[model samples]
Target: MNNVKNLNKWANAHTYLSLDLVRIALGVFLFMKGISFITNIQYLQDLISPIDKIGGGMFLIHYIAPAHMVGGIMIAFGLLTRWAIIAQLPILIGAIIVNFMGEMHSQNLLLAILILGICVFFLFYGSGKHSADYYFKMQQ
Candidate 1:
């Protein structure tokens, strides 16, 4: 019981800094992914092209590129973090779906899940103490 208490105290103490780092890393990753999509739009389009016949595919194609770029930037800067996370969630889920539907390797699924998990973590943690949100709060 004492050990558990000590562990909990340690975790609480480190959680903020750990999560802030996570937010920054996740932001960088998503931003890079966005840039990849922008630079290689045709290749990505080919990947998603199969789903184009589906009802929502058109919508996804239309919005996903911008979402990645804009959402990625927002997340990286911790600007409107929650909303940025929300915007990116659908894109990540869509990628998961596409990978599954394409019969890609299990590792792809794991990677997507890991990335999604990080996004969800930031969603709940609110960008921690090292974000634009924190800076804005300080100014106000």
Candidate 2:
């Protein structure tokens, strides 16, 4: 019980360090990928060409790119971080769905899993610095 108290004290003290760093890293990583999804239409088409070859409309592709980019920006900015992480789930899931399973190994899957883990972490524990939760704490 005493050990648990000490651990909790340490956690609360270091909250800003671990939480903010993770949030910033996650945000930037998502931002770059988001930009790629939005700006590089040809790339998106190439990877998912099977869908279109079978008659997936231009409309779906058009919307997906922008949505990915916008979602990335929101995550990076720590605006609705949980929602943004939740939003990214589809794009990664879609990649797994549309891509040949054999083409992906554990490495690729791990990256997706890692991103989801990061999102889940932030969802449960808000970015602790200069974030809405932090501000509220400061008020208290």
**Winning model by lDDT:** 1
* lDDT score of residue 39 within candidate 2: 76
Model 2 C-alpha RMSD to native:
6.0
Per-residue lDDT of candidate 2, residues 1-140 (tens digit): 57634544454566766567677777777777767766777876776665666675486577666666676666656666657667777766666555554355566567777876777776555455545544555689
Candidate 2 deviant stretches above 4 angstroms: 1-14, 50-60, 100-102, 105-107, 136-140
Q: How does each model score on TM-score?
A: 0.80, 0.66
- Pairs of residues clashing in candidate 2: none
- Scored against the true structure, residue 87 in model 2 reaches a CA lDDT of 72
- Model 1 residue 71 lDDT score: 79
Total clashing residue pairs per candidate?
Answer: 0, 0
Model 1 — TM-score against the truth? 0.80
Q: What's the CA error at residue 11 for candidate 1, in Å?
A: 12
Residue-wise C-alpha lDDT for candidate 1, range 1-140, written one tens digit per residue: 57634543454455676676777778777778778877887867876765666767657766877787787777878788878989988888977888867758588688789999988876665656567766786799
Clashing pairs in 1: none
